[model samples]
Each structure stands twice: as structure tokens, then as C-alpha cells.
Target chain A: MKQSAKLNTVNKWWQYETTASQKWFQFGLKDLYYNRGLILRFTRRDLLASYQQTVIGPFWIFLQPLLTALVYLIVFGRFAKMPTDGIPPILFYLAGSTIWSFFFDSLNGTMYTFISNTHIFNKVYFPRLVVPMSIILTQAVRLGIQLVLFALIYVFYYFIFHTASPSKILLLLPLLVLLTAGFAFGLGLLISIITAKYRDLDNILQFFLRLFMFATPVVYPASIIPDKYQALFWLNPLTPIIETFRAAFVENGKIPYYPLAIAGIEIFFLISLGLLLFKKRELDVMDSI
Target chain B: MRELVLKAENISKYYRLGLIGSSSLKQDLQNLFVKSRDGLTVEDPQHIWALKDVDFELHAGEVIGIVGRNGSGKSTLLKILSRIARPTTGSVRWKGKISSLLEIGTGFHAELTGRENIFLNGQILGLSNAEVKTRFDEIVAFSGIERFLDTPVKRYSSGMYVRLAFSVAAHLRSDILIIDEVLAVGDIEFQLKCIAKMKEISRLDGKAILFVSHDMQTIRNLCTTGIYLEKGRIKLIGDPPKAIAGYLNLDTQLSKHTYSSPHEAPGNSYIKIKRAELENSTIIHFEFWYTAEGNENLSIGIMLYNDLGQCVFDLASAPTRMENGLIKGACTLPENFLNEGQYVLSIAFIGDQSKLLFDFADCLNFNVQDNGKNLRWYGKRVGIVRPEFPIQLLNIDRDGAI
Candidate 1:
């Protein structure tokens, strides 16, 4: 009665072959845009959490970092004779501390992207990339505050000594910061992906990042490293990052092209690779967890 | 005629037991055998399939129920289909985008307000902003919490929290919907509404729905077909009634009936007893499955054990109550009798005054199942206490027999 069911409906099948190089990028980009509201809420939450019950409110962003920078300038830069080029000790330490803080903040927070956000991932299937990406973006706001403080410091010094003018190349400052962020984001996301599958990698990362602090030019300039080890500094991705940032703003306001190119390539590579690794894990990490 | 929309073929997942994937000698030996055989990995030595070469073809608009006991690979199958997890072997092919609501409100930001969280939760479920906005009003209307839209979800009542979360998931646009025990949350009215919505989504939208649940009624009401799973393998896959009958009747038919019954129980005053067996024989759960059948009293009998190492109480109310009601044969225990202490319970089917329906004692030591008061109160487990206390007649206007 049904015409032999399946035998009555023989069908032809055609295979579609297509390369989707931009598919992953589109996925990430679309996810980021769609979830912008969520990132916004997280940003506000971060601000609120920092100064929820404080008398001074959200201004604590500037006041807290300013206080710390002042303390470091007094204790380490002046008292302990920690070398601070020709710039005032306060500006020197403040500039270095603020940028380094952003790098470390993104890296340290991204490492826990899997463990800390396990609760969220267990219940829903959001692009897990959003977790670390949102964190980096939020921390960027914090770094912005430090930039404003630097501007204010520049003005005060300009009025007082008339010798603290930033070069026209200071326009490149934002690019340096962005590149640094890219490097940090890529590195953090990469580590987080690895740690999600094999948690033992987490312990090693904790130790490695600590050593990485010294390897980069956070507390000291890269010139402090001996000439032979200068090339070694190039191997550390954060090296070109911090160096370019400081050179464009705190130093001669010009990029060191060779090392900067190396850093840029490393960053782009890290981000793309991090995304691929994370996608692979996202294929079935909830099962393992 | 409906087209075949989904197919899952021979999927299995293996997990290492110890910390950092450290497998024991026994597990290793078992794995060695399975590997040499190339397709023999199972939780049970006698059974070789954590989801045995499972094969099923789902037609468009089909509502399928996956019924399985604990560790039966129901959740695992859902995970694979949802793409949240992968199987160690085999593949799942589906016709359209899939959105799996494993648990509602998982991605809700605690600090974000109800409205803000809707956006977040919607996006997490794979909806774009424009789509969420279009359905935003409908979702809020469905949740019935418009007044508290601006209030942080942290401040919302537990019911309100689940309502908002469920609304977001239900509004997802994917054509293939996989839900895992979501109906186990929310109030009865809300749970019924969710099931209705899910049914509507499947029926009207022509979506392929794979629903996982322990509630037989919901499964019967929602599914066109069902699959019975045991030890990560498909036992039966066919019509809902037949599949459920197979699953419901599986535990009642094992050769070596295994159960958790108190060995040497005590008398009343925080007593517990349990007796699980196959047929007329004793049960050893670690060895084999068990089956049962009987008269009005034929059921999972239970006895209360006190500190003195003996059963002081024995009762079987499920069948007695069901003789005059809809629940035909069920094994249940009243909540009021279970005290807040460690008491072993015997698994048996008995009547009033310790009338032994089938007293197979010393089966396995069982403790009182913990009933959490948090969000889980919405499950079928709520209101288990059916105590009939003789109250002093205070003041009552008898208005009945209408």
C-alpha cells in the first residue's frame, strides 16, 4: 500500500565541499557582538565590586593605583635606588606598574577561565571564548584609568619643569597598548585552554608566570638585561610588548620595529592558536569536567 | 511523510576513574579485553557497551524520550547530541542547529538584574540580540515576572529564578531541542507549562526534540517514541508505551536481583530498612539486576531499623493507596517517619502491621535518601509525607459535599 516504503523513494545525494577559513572568526565575532550586553554588565559589576561600599566610590580606581604608585616611587625608586631613567620616580614607576598590571591581570584571570567559570559552562553553551575575552576587555578599562593618570602627571610636570612633553609619536601609544593586550590575551587564552583539559598544567603555569614577571620589563627596563641576553629577551613575548609601550611613551616615543614585528606575529599566532585549541576542547570538555 | 532528521550511531565514552585519569588494575584489565575485542567496553563485565552501538533515526517533529537508570548513559547521549561533549566512538548526525538546555539559569549572572540576565541567558543559549529582543516580551510574559524585571536575579525568589531561566531557554531558535531533566525544576503549574511549551515547540515548529527525564508521566505525555538504556547501552527503542514498559520492567527481571536492604536493623525511633531482590530470591546489587511482581502488596517493601539492630516498622503504602487511585504499582516511603539520623532501611514489600509480603532481609545496607530543601524541592520528590494526624477540632465550618 505504501509502495514498498523506502524502495518507492530512492534519493540521490550530493556532497558539498567548501573551505571555511573565516568561519571560526565569524563565529567568534558574532558571539562577541551578541553577548556585548553581558560584557557590559560584567564591566559594571567589576566597577561596583571595587567600590561598592567605599566612601569615595568608583574614584577608588585612580586613588588606589595612585597611592600604590606613590608608595613604590618612595620605597623602591628613591629609597632603594631602583633605577628610574631620567623621568621622575613617580611617573616612571606609575607608568610601568599600570601597564604591567593590565598584562598580569588578563593573564592570571584568563588562566582560571575554565575552573572559575565551570559553573556557567556546566549549565549553558555559550562560546567559552567570551569568558576570557570579556575579562581582558574589562581590565582594559582599568588600564585606561591609569592612562588618564599618566596624562595628568604629564601636565603637572609640564607646568612645574616645562621639560615633560610627550613626543608626537605618543600617538602610537594606543597601538602599543592594544598590541600588549593582544599578546596577553592570546597567551592567557592559550594557557587556559591547555589547563582545562589537563589541570596539572595549571600548577606549572602559576610557577611559570611568576618567573615570567622577571623575564619581562615590568619592574625594570629591558636594557638591564646584558647584551648577550638581550636576544633572549626577544624570546619572551611580553618583552617587545612592554618595551614598545614604554619606548613610545616613557622613552623616545618610537617603536623598535624588528622585535615589535616578532611580538606582533607571536601575538596573532597565539590568539588564533588559542581559539583553535579552545574550540577543540569545547567539543566535549563538559564531559571530562 | 516526515523526513528522518537525526541519527546517532554506536557512540561510547570511556572515562578514567582515579585522580588525573589513573585507572586501576581491574579497570585496566577490563579495558585490555575490550580493546583487544575492538568494541567491548562496558560498565558491566557481562555487558559490553557504554551505549552499545546505539542506533536511532528521529523523524521531523518527533518527540523522543530517553529513559535510563543511573549511569545508563542518558545524560551522555544528550551531551553528545548537544555538542557539549563528544563520544569516544561513533557519530551523531542531525539536520539542523541544536540548542541543549541541560540546566536552566546556568549562565545567568547573579549580580545582573532579571532583564539584564535575560539578555545574557539568551545569548548563552545561542540567540542573537535582535532575536532575543523580539522574543523578549513573550519570554517575560511567559515567566510572569514583569514587575521584578529590573531587580537583580539574586533577589528573586527561587521560583522566579527558575521561571526566568526557563523562559530564556524555551525561546531559543534552534530546530533541534535537547532538554535534560529541566522539568524536574519549578512548581507543578510551571513544570506543566514548560512541558506544554516543549510539546508545542516540537509539534508546531516541526522540531526534533530529544527529551531526557525520569518522570514516566511526562515522558508518556510528550514523546512519540522512547528508548530504554541500561549501563550505557540501548535496551529498547520503539513506541513510547513499549519502551517505557521495557524500562519499567527491566529492574523487575534480573537473574541475580541486587538491592540495598538493611542487614541487621534496629527497632523504631529513627528506624530504616530496605530489601531489594530479583523474584522470590535474595538480592545482591553488585552482582546482578532484580525483578518483582505481586498482589496489592507486591512492591518494594521497606522496614525501619533502629539502633538495636532490628526492624521495628514495616509498611507498604504505595500499592494500598494505588488500589483505589491512579498509581497502580509503586514503591514509596513516607517522609515523616524518616528521622534525622543514620538508620538502615530494609527493602521489602509489606502491608500494615509488618505483614511480610516478601521478607528477604540482609540484602544491602541502605541509608535514608537525602532530600535537599534548596532548588530541588520542585522535583517529583516534594510533599512525600502523607501523614494522617488526628487533630483536636478547633473551629471549622464544614462546607463540603457540593
Candidate 2:
């Protein structure tokens, strides 16, 4: 029996076809582009709702990094007697905390993308990538606020103490931010997909992220890592980005070209692998959830 | 030739029961070792087919109703069609953009104001920001929540939330619209208005629709064609009435004369319907033993429904003071109230001011045989109720009629 007849030579027809062994490598760029408005709205919603009902509202965004940096200054610079490579403890820790917080927030937020948004994901079909992408963008806004705060402090120290001066490497600030965001987003996406199936990964993710922060040069200057362990430090994808960011802002800080190049290669691979896994799992992940 | 809007070919889905994560990499490696030793692949016994070999076609402006009992793959089909879930097999091809309201208020954040949520939800449903801005007033007006538009949606009543969500979904300008049972959320008035708007869009705007609903009356009223699914396969397809009848027939076939004991019965702990049988294809006899607990104001009600899922008539015994024991009660229907067709009898226990305690839907099924009163008529009866009304023909002067 002729159950259904295939329409041939259709003009402008959209086909939704799938198979058991389908392979997809293309990032759903078209879907992401079309739903860019959703991404922006989601980002706005996240920003608005994050601090709702709080007494200070968005002041928490700036206050969080400020407080964190102060704690790091007292604990690491004042008590631990860690060397700051001639950079002021406040300046060094503030710069590190600001950049590190962006990476941490983006990674941690996107890491729960599938699990936290299961209700919306199960009911609706937009690009699944939109959720993680929106998460990164939302973190970008917080990063912007934190950067302004950092800039204010840097200017104060620059004129008052006449200690730190900007370098031409500061021109690479955009590239540094991109590298950090790319690495965090990629790892977060990969972890989110894994956690969707194995929920135990979610439990481990927080502990891992905390440990990872210490592994990178978030609390102390990269110059203090000692000469022998420098290579091991650069093994982490975040080390070069954070070191380069500090180099851009602080005098005597160095941007190691070889380490930076290796980090870039690693970022590309991590992001590509993350996208591949995300695209493959997104179709059937809801059922498992 | 009219344009084809969507075509689905041999779609199927399989689901595995039990823990999803237990089948981890370690388990897979163990399975591989076992397979290598045995030289044969072992099948997981916990797997069940949610949908199997389903095929259908929809055209522009066509409305199709999908009907089935729970776990019969109605939701599975909708998920695949909406692209929320991928089919395990087969392919679906379509023309033009498809917008699905599988659920209303899918991504609505409680902290966002109603106005903000509208734009957010609109964009999520595939509308551009400019498009949403242009239709902003109309959406708010349709939702009838203009006074509360600036309030956070968490503060809005559930009805207001559903109304706003539905309004945004209604304005989606896709070529095909997929709706699940979201209309069941709001009040009857809002539901009616949504149905009207959907009808207008399909009829005037020429958009195809695939509606999944358990409300048979709504399906009968709106759908031109229907698909009845049973056990993950299409049991019947074609005209809405015929498909509905076939679906009802499947119910009766499963539950014929009597209900089993409490352990096997399809009821709750408060009541265990022991036996339900139909007599003379007209009178319904049912017996249930209830544990009254402490309340004495318990009454039993039975509703009879036809094949179209419309309740034909209902009968309720007046609330009687009773003790906790095995209580027996039987009721008969009004004579000649039902037409010659299949009917399902559902029994429910009611307490104080008609609060439903337990409802056993489709507990008993019986067929009403035609009494040969319409032997001279060439066709079957056309309605659920067949009552003979006396008619008087008046033929006064036809030529003098002005």
C-alpha cells in the first residue's frame, strides 16, 4: 500500500529528517542567528532577575568581585606573604579576580545549562545552543560591570601611587577576553552535556571548579609559580589568558608568546569538541532527562 | 494540486525504562566483554517502543487531531513533529516554518514583568524583535491584562499567565502550528477564545495545524481528520467521527463486561469497584465496595458516555449515611435515552457538595443494539441521543402561501 508519497522538486521546502546514525558537525549557526533575539532577551531576563528582591540589586555584581578581591589580598598577600612581582596587592588581586570571576561565572553558569533549563528545553524547540550562548553573553554583561570597577581602582592607583602603567600589550585585551570566554564556554558545554546524563558530574563540577581556580594564577601572580613549574602551569588553558591580561595591565608582567599560542590551539580543540558533543546529544538528551 | 505542508514517513521511537545513567561507560565495557565471550549481542529487556512505524501526511490548511490514551505515543509523536525529540527511525519533511505551542509559557521567567515576558516568549517562538514590537499592543489587548502588564508575571494569577502565554503563541506567523493540550490550562471562556483564534488562523491564514488533545468534544468540533493511536501504532485514521468511534471501540474491547477485583481494578484506594455490567444494552448495573473511613456523607454517581467521548447522561444517588463496610448499589438508566452505538460507563464516588472522590472512567462498555425500529431507513442513526418526538404535518394551501 502507498502509505505516503514523497513530494518531488518542492520549492523552498524545509525538511526535518533524522536517522539512527546521523552525523552532524556543522554548528547550528543559522538557527543561532535566527534566534539571536531570544539570546538577547534571555540575557536581559537573566540580568534583571539575578538580583531581583535583593536590597542592592545590581550592586551585588560589583560588590561580589570587590569583596572577593579584598579577601584574596588579605589572605594571600598580607598573611601568606606571596610575592606580587612589584605590583600592588590590591591591583594584582583585583585584576586577577575581575578576569577570573568572568571565566568562573560563565563556566559555572553554562555548566548547568541543560539541567537547569530542562523544563523549557523539554517543552520547546529553539536552538539548544542558545541557552549556553545566552549564558556566556549574560556573564559578559557582569564582566563589563566588573571591568569598569577594576578600571576605577587601576586609575586611582596609577595617579595616587604612580606605581602601575599600561602597556601596548593592553591592545590585545579583546583577544584575551575572547580566549577566556571561548575556553570556559567550551568546557562548560561539554560538562553540561555529560551532567545531563550522569548527574554525579554536577556534584563534582563545583569542587572541580574551585580546585581549578587555584591551579590557575587567579590568587597570585604567574611570576611567583617558580621557573620549573611554569610549563606545567601553562598546561591549563586559562593560565595564559589570565597571565596575558595581567601583562596588559601591570608593568614587568610578561605575555609569553609560546604559551599563548599553545593555549589558543587548546581552546580551538576544546570548543570544537564541545560543539560536536552538544549537537550530537541535544536531540535525544531531553528523553534521558 | 494543493501544496503539502508536512509529511512523516515511518516514524518510530524507543524508550528504555529504569535508571538512565546506570548504563554508563563501565557497563558498556562489561557488556562488550560479555558479548565477546558469548559471541552474541544481548538485548536490554527493559526497552519499550513508544511509537512504531507511524506515517501520515498533512496539507496546507488541514487540521488533524491526534487521539490516544496515556502512553499510547500521542505525546511522543508531537515531540518528534515539533523537533523537540528526534525519532529513532524514519524522516519527516515539511515546507515553511513550523511553530509549536507544545506548552504555553515555555520559557516564562517568574521574575520578569508580563510585558517583558511577552517579548521574551515571542522571540522564543521564532518571532523577530521588530515583529514583537509591532504586535505588542495587540498581544496585550488580546490577553486582557493591560492593567497588570507591568507587574511581574509571578504576581499574575495563573489564568492571566496562561492568557498572556497563549496570546503570544496565537500570533506566531508560521505555516504549520502544533498545539498540545495547553488549552486545558485556562478557564472555559479563554479556552473558547483560543480555539476561535486558532480556527481563524487555520481557516483564514491557511496554516496547517496538528492538535493533540484528550478532549474528544474539542477534537470533534475542530478537526477535519483524525488519527487514533493504540499501543504505539495507528489503529485507525480518516474522518474524525470514524476515528473517534474506532478509538472508543478499542476501549470497549479492553474493558468488556465486568471490572476485576481491587488489586486489578482501575480505581483508587477509597473505593474498589467489584462488578460493572450492562443489561439489555440500556440499563447499567454497577457494584462497588467503599471504605468510608470516617465520612458518612458519601454518594455514588455514574456517567454514561458515547463513542465520541461526550457524556450522554449522568445519574447520581442521593447522599446517604453509611458505615464502613462492603456496600452494594445498582442503578438503571432512563429508557431509550441512548442511540444504537457503543457506550462506556464510568462510575465516580461523590461527597459533600458534589466533590468527586474517585472516578473510574471507561470502567464498563456495552453495545446498544438497534431494535429494528429504523428498518425502513437505509442508514444508521446519526446522533448519540435517539428520542421519538411526535410530528404533525400541516399542508394548508401551498398556492395561497405568500
Candidate 3:
């Protein structure tokens, strides 16, 4: 309804006239902020969905990661003699696993948000970004639990092993997290779009993620790779993120420059591409789904 | 005489049919090749048109109902309007901060309490944080879930959950409201609340509303105008009653039949009457046949419920002429049956008693118009039989002259 002619001219559905071209972009940002509420709900759902039936709640969060770190320490670090760059294998492996698990959870979980939330999407209209963004927040809770575990181990390593310092790039830890989330959302969005047409991607994502865990340096240090594959290893943007996380936290406050910047750039590119594809798919995907 | 809020131009939507598998894809590709030589097969390569060339406008203070049978484009239009999905062709234009109450709990967390889900569900519908907080109390109170405010919704009963969700939606102050059949998911009282809330939104706020509902009474009460859709096309658009009548005509809910002879039906169809009588009976069962326009005269059957909860035996009429022709119809039951109760009739069409033909479930309901039998029923209708059962008793005096 037109309360005023000027307001009517600016933006109103009655006239079917969209406002200044620049306003649409601003709407997208505001839409994102508004959708943050659903993201919060989704995050809550994601974090607690697994533990809903359990007697002991989030304690499992700490126990699972701690137990996983222990298993890796015995199997790969002690039994196999895997490399840890002269650091205690437990501390080193926990550092890498802490970041890797968060990224993987977000990437793998978000890959199905579109499909999982289709029931809701078909029934209502909100920004689709709420789904992927929710996964990021949900996984953050899981990662937070793991971080507390990492702190306990860090304390043991510091007073016990006489090592461990807060990374100078700890100030940039927020940026690192953003980069990790951005890459996961970006790639997951791309995969979800393809999934509507070719559903095998769902199966591949589950299979390849486990396989990809072996490929990443979660247990063994990255140094085991020969010089020739160093370039190839960089292709997986996670290589440097996981490696940088390990080096900065465990290697005593040293920041790796080239690898961090490369990961950032790669994450930026993937997100941009993913958004483009996502926007295009939003136009008519309900029919396909 | 208020303000124009929205307009659409030649908007159309397309949908693909069939399952998600290899066979569907193979058919799609085959349809694609066939459509290449033609124009505008865009409505689905399987060659089904979900919506075609729809145009409409809405004033700010309007509550319009869209009614249609299944597969109509009512949902398709709502999807495009809400921006959940897009149209295949044409465009929709509007001016406002649009909000839809399509699905109330789109992303509700089972772990979250009612208080938490208020913000979550509000945001899912495009409401801002300040907007949600402003009306949070009203939402909780409206649902009458004050005690369970802190409890997780997963622990709440489905009715309670629907109440909470609907309450959140009802409290929203939005520019445009697009409500789907989601309200029907709630209980009757809750549905009444939802309809009342929408009425206020449309009348008081002057928010342009596009409502889709199967409940005719609700549609008549809430909507000022209506659009009747048939197979993806706008068949009629006018006053609510007229549009509804036209739509119902196409659907044909109430069926009626009368016959002189069973075998000598209107045509060569072999339709024989299994039973007949309008007398009150318990759970009245009437059977008929299935006949096509030009095929074998199939006998379809119907069962009607009358005053009283008593259920009579099954009456079946089958072995139709097996082609198109007039069908036989009848209703029968034992005598002195019905006691007293409200009732509605059910008619099922089946290949046999086991094989289903068509189930027009609960097609019609009528009042018994009680006769004066209890306490002399002074206030009720005074008659020998409830319906004045077309009978007479006469006394013959000794002398006609006297």
C-alpha cells in the first residue's frame, strides 16, 4: 500500500517496480542476517541430533574426540612410527584432528542440508543459505568441545612436555575459522546443487570423505610426502589449513605464510562459484527435487 | 478502495512427474527429443502443464482464496509468490517486506525450548530479531503453552507443537501474507484460531493475503474473493461463493441417482439393483456399478448414513453391462433400525468389495429433523414420523353425512 508517493516510487509490489539495482544486493545481506535465526535453530538441531537419545549429553563430544586421538596415537604414532616433527604424537595429532573434524563435519553435514530440509523448503520460503550457515554454527559447538579437550592436552604438554605456546596467529584464529567454514560451505553448496540431478554425489561424498580422511595429515605429519607431491598436496585447500593449524599451535607460535594465503584465496574462489550455482539453482529446483 | 499491493504477468510454472530413478530419466530424455520439434513444451517434458499464462492483481486490503482440485496450480503459484521456488515463464512483481506462514516450524529444533523456537521460527519466515522479540510474549500466550515455555518442543505433543508453531506465525506483523494448507495440520480449535488470525491480518493490517484452503466453510468466511483453478489454469475468478460453486461443479462431490428397473437401465449397461429403500437404518450400505460413457454399463454403489449410529448390512450391486450406459442405484436395510444420532454417508467405488473403484469419502451430510417422540418433544417437530413418512390412518364414521 502506498502511504506516500515517494515511498511508493522507491520500492513497492503494487507497481511491480523494483527499486534501484543496488538495493537488491543489500537485500541479500539483510536476508542473510534475518536467516541467522533459523541458522541458530539448525545449528542446535545439528549438534544435538545425535545425542538426543543419550543419558549423558555433550560429554560424548569430549569423549569421542579424546578417544579418537588416543586410537590414532597408538595405531599410527606408536605402532607405525609415524612422523610428528619431534613433538608428542598425541598433541600433534589432536591439533590437526581438532580442525579437520570441524571442517569435515561442516562439509559433509552441509552437503545434505538442502535435501534434508527440502520438506521445510517446499512448505515455506526463506533464504536457503540458512541451512548451510546453520551447519557451520552446529559444527562450531562440536569443535568447541574438541577445543576444550585440546586445551587439557595442551596444558599437559606445556607443564609436562615443556612445550606449547599460544600462536601469534591466534589473533588470526577467527580468520582461519572463517576460511575453513567458507571452503566447506562453498564446496558443499556446489555438490548439493549437482545432487538434485545426479544423486550419486551423495554416496560419493560419504565414501570419499572417509577416503579423504586417510589422504589428509590428521595422524601422520605432512612431512612424509615426497617433494614432488607437495604441489599436488596443496591442491586440497585443507592441506595448509590443517598443516598451519598444527604448526602454529604445536610448533610454538610460528605462522606459515604462503600456504595460509593460498588456502584463503582458494576458499574465496570456491564460495563465489558455489553461490553463483546456488542462486541459479534456486530459480527452479523445487520442480526437480 | 484502499491500495494496490501486487501484480503478476503471464506467470506459469512447470513440473516433472514420475519417480527419481533411471526409468524416469529415460522417459524424460525421450520426451525431450519429441519436444525439440515443438514450441513451448517447457511445461514438463513428460508433457504436463502445471500452470499456464496466469495473471492477477491484489489490493492491499484483500484476502483472496484460491480453490481447486488436486494437481491444480494453487500450490505452484504460492511457491512462486513466496520465492521458495520459481516460475517457468512470466514474472511476479510486488512492493513490500513480504512474509509467508507457509510452514510454521520449518527449522524448529527438537532440543530447543518453546522460548528458543520463537526466534528460530520467526527468522525462518523472514522476520527480524527485534520484530520477534516485540511479539514473543503474545506468541507464547496465544499458544497457551506458558508452563511448557522452557520445555523442548520434541517433548510436546504434536497438537501442542502445532499450537506453538501456529502461534508464532499468527503474531507476525507482515506486509503480505501467503498462507498454504498448512493450517489444516492443526486441530479444529487451533485451525479456528489460525483462520481468525488471518482474518485480522487481512482486515485490520490491510495486508494482501493469498490463501489456499480445502475447507469450504473457512474459505467462505475468510476470503472476500476467490480464484478457481482447474488443471493449472484459472477457470474462474470472482466472488467467493461463485468461484467455489464453479470449482465444486467440476469436482462433483454430491452424486444422486434414481431408477425404475435395474436391468433395463438408461443404456445397454448391465446394472441390477441389489437393494433399495430410504427408510432409516443402521449404517446404511448401498451398492452400485461402474459404467463408462460408451463402455459397459457398470453398476457403482453408495452407502448412506442416516439418523442413528446403527450400521446395517452391506448391500452390493455389481455385474454391470460392462460398458457405457445408465447406472442403477439403491439403498436398503432391515426395518425398525435407527434410534437417534447425526450421520453422514460414505460411497466407495471398487472393482469388487475388495478392489477399490473410487472412494468419494463422506460425500454428504443431512439433518434428521427429529420428530416429537421424547418428552412428547414439545419443542421439536410434532409429527407421527420424523420426516412425515408419507402414510395416513383414517377413521370411517357410520354415516358419511355425519
Model 1, which residues run further than 4 Å from truth? A1-57, A249-254, A284-286, B20-49, B250-402
**Which residue segments of model 2 deviate by more than 4 Å?**
A1-14, B21-24, B28-44, B250-277, B280-364, B367-402
Residue-level lDDT for B371 in candidate 3: 39
Candidate 3, residue B365: lDDT: 44
How accurate is chain B of model 3, given as a TM-score from 0 to 1?
0.65
Indicate which candidate wins on TM-score: 2
The TM-score of predicted model 2 comes to: 0.80
All models, RMSD in angstroms: 11.6, 10.2, 9.0
Candidate 1 vs candidate 2, TM-score winner: 2
B1-402 per-residue lDDT for model 1 (tens digits): 797777676677665433432323466487678777875334543343345567787777999999876568887677667665556777665555678888888767766688878877786777766788999999999999999999878889999999999988888868778899988889999998988888888899888898888777788899999998877888888888778766655223333332344334322212232323332122222211222232333244556443223244665445442242112222344444343323334455444434444444433333333444433443333332323355686646577555
- DockQ of the candidate models in sequence: 0.23, 0.41, 0.37
* lDDT tens readout by residue for model 3, B24-122: 445658767866867454544454667888888888879889987657888778877887767667767777767776767776888778887887788
lDDT tens per residue, model 3, A216-240: 8888777898999887776677777
The estimated TM-scores of all candidates read 0.72, 0.80, 0.76
The top-ranked prediction according to lDDT is 2
**Which 10-residue window in model 3 chain B sums to the lowest lDDT?**
B305-314
